[model samples]
Target: MIANVLTIAGTDPSGGAGIQADIKTMSALGAYSCSVVTAVVAQNTCGVRSFQALSPDFVAAQIDAVLEDVRIDAVKIGMIANAGIAGAVADRLTHHRARNIVLDPVMVAKSGHALLDPEAVSAVRERLVPLASVITPNLPEAAVLLDRPDDWSVPAMRAALPALMALGSDHVLLKGGHLEGEDSTDLLAGPEGTQAFRAPRITTTSDHGTGCTLSSAIAALLPHHPMPEAVARAKAYLHAALAQSDALDVGQGHGPVHHFHALWASDG
Candidate 1:
């Protein structure tokens, strides 16, 4: 059966990140996609200009409306915007007993724009993180969540895993893309143990939506695969998408990955 994945996120008009990227990633990974918008953002490859978050009540209503009808196989959450939205989302998802929840703690955009409110950090860490099946956080995001300096090396990342797992997520995928290296590695820590997944860092500016894409890919695959397998496949898919990203000319600063890279190649 096709997995029905729901993405609760903000928007990026440029289509490289946020709800647009989530839907694209889910669809590319062969999952039926649905969405609930938390904010309407005016952003492009250059950066975010402004954003207006929806009311907490409305956000909760959207979640209830979807969960009440669709059989959501999994959910990918990004950019809650504020503490109210975070609490609302957590409450509604909990009420619905949502499964296969993949939470990407998106704090900032690629262009150095703050996508999440500072006050919302605690709400996300306390309310949302506990409910996630897997929480994907980059070095900077991890630092903010843990109230520690960003991990600068693999060993540092390893040391931080226990602390991150203590946040109550069943699994934590600590991304090492921020470290300057030839390869980008992610450390996955769970009840079984920790494992590293590494890929040669593709040199390109077309990496606008990588985080959103990866988390949504995992959500799309979780219904059919185990956590580790889903993460591995999602990593592979993102790698391929990054490898082919430069082919498309979407924006000036940072363009989006070619989500349909495999499909387009097959068609051609």
Candidate 2:
């Protein structure tokens, strides 16, 4: 079956994160991608220079246009940067339901620029997150969402995982890449308790779109396979993408992880 995935998020002109990353990741994982762009970022590896958000009505229309035709099996949501867009997308999904909905609560850029308005946190937690099948939050985003400071330890990180689960997702993948550690461990806590994926620290500046890629991978994979199996496969794909990130010389500053890495080697 062709897994049709709908990605509702912002556009990254740099092609590292946001809507671009979601589209690339979904298609690479064998899913057809449909996008509803919430905002457009004038961004590159250095960081996001500027951004312009679409009106809530336009965002909804984009989603409607896609869902009206394509049979969206899964939904992967990235940077819904404001409360209005978040609500619009969440409310829209009430009717156009996908079997798998992965929410990557993208609040900050890789370069530390805040993407979502701080005020929109309530809107996300209350309106959007509860509606998701899975919610993926990195350390900083988790801390902010949970109202904890940045001084959280591994135990603290694990502690917040349950709270994220409580927010109503069937599963919660709390990415620990932002946590200081020798090996980065992302905690997947859900009804089955926890599953951890640990990878050696891949010290690279090209880590811009990893979250978007991972969530989209989950969304794409889950419709065809079980969640645990899907998450494991998605993590591996992202690791390989990060490992081969050097192949893409797309921009001047921090670049995107190479999605075509496997293709280049296999075709040669």
Candidate 3:
């Protein structure tokens, strides 16, 4: 069956991140996509200029409308701009018993713009983290979530796993893209232990929406594959997208990844 994946996120008009990227990633990965917009952000590949979040009630209603009719196979949640929206999302997903929840703790954008409200951090940690099947947080996000200094090494990332797991997620995908190296390694920690998935770091400024794309890919693949397999496949997909990102020229700053790299290749 083609999985129906729901993405609860903010918007990026540039179409590189947020709900737009989620939909594109899901469709590229062969999943049916649905979305609930939490905020409308004025951002391009360069940076975020400003944003306005939807009311909590409106966001909840959108979730309800989708959940009431569609059978959501998995959910990829991105930017919940504030605490109220976070709580509302947690409550609605809980009430509906949504499964295969993949939470990307999106705190900052590629251009160093803050996407999430600092005050909402505790609410997301308390309400949303535990409900997720897996939570993906890069070094800075993990540090902020854990109230610790940013980890600069793999060993520090490894050592931080238990504390991150204690956040109540069944699995934690601690991304090491921020670490300086030839390979971007991501640590997947679950009840069994931690495992590393590595890929050569593709050198390109076209890295916008990478985090959103990765998490959404995992959510799209989870219905048919186990956690480890899903994560591995998602990593591979993102790697390929990043590798071919230079093929497209979208913005002045970091451009979007080529989500349709395979399809475009076939066409050529």
Candidate 4:
């Protein structure tokens, strides 16, 4: 059966991140993609110029529209934007008893624009974090969630895992991309303990939608694969996408990773 994946995220007109990236990632992985936009962002690789978040009721309606009609296999959530929207999403997901929930705690953009409201942090922790099967947070995001200084070292990331998992996720994938290293290592820690995935850092500027892409890929694969296998496969797919990122000439600033790298490569 084809997996039906739903993504609740903000919109990126640049098509590099948020709902655009999630849909692209899901489609590339052979899953049918659905989306609910929480905010409309006027942004590009350079930075976010402005954004308008939708009403919480509107966001909730969009989620219900999809869940009530389709048999959603998994859900990928990103960029809640505010506390009200975050609470609304969490409430709806709970109502549906959603499965295979993958939450990417998107707080800031690569261009240094804050995507999540500081006021909404508590809402995400209280409402959304507990609902996730897996929570993917980069070092900075993890720090914000835990109310600590940004620490990206391997040891720091490893030490922080159990505390992150304590937020109610079954697993925590602490991304180490921000750490200065020859290899970009991601640590996945959970009840089964921890495992690390290391890949030679793809030196490119086309990493606009990496977080959205990775979390969506995991959501897409979860219906058929276990947590560890899903994470492993998602990392493999991300590495391929990052390697081919230079091919996409989208923006003058950081461009987007190639979501269909596998298909394009196979076609050649």
Model 4 TM-score (2 dp)? 0.98
Clashing pairs for model 4 are: none
The models' CA-based lDDT, in order, is 0.95, 0.86, 0.95, 0.93
lDDT of 3 at 267: 43
RMSD of 4: 1.2
lDDT tens per residue, model 2, 80-179: 8888998888878987775688999989888888889988899999888888888889888888878888776678877788778877888888888877
Model 3: colliding residue pairs: none
- What's the count of clashing pairs in each model shown? 0, 1, 0, 0
Q: Write the per-residue lDDT of candidate 1 for residues 1-268, one digit (tens) a residue.
A: 9999999999999999999999999999999999999999999999999999999999999999999999999999999999999999999999999999999999998888898999999999999999999999999999999999764799999999999999999999999999998999999999879989999999999999999999999999999999999999999999999999988989898999999998886434
Local error of candidate 2 at 127, Å? 1.1
Query: Model 2 TM-score?
Result: 0.96
In model 2, what are the clashing residue pairs, if there are any? Answer: 45-254
Q: Lowest-lDDT window of 10 residues in candidate 1?
A: 259-268
Q: Which residue pairs show collisions in model 1?
A: none
| lDDT computed for candidate 4 | 0.93
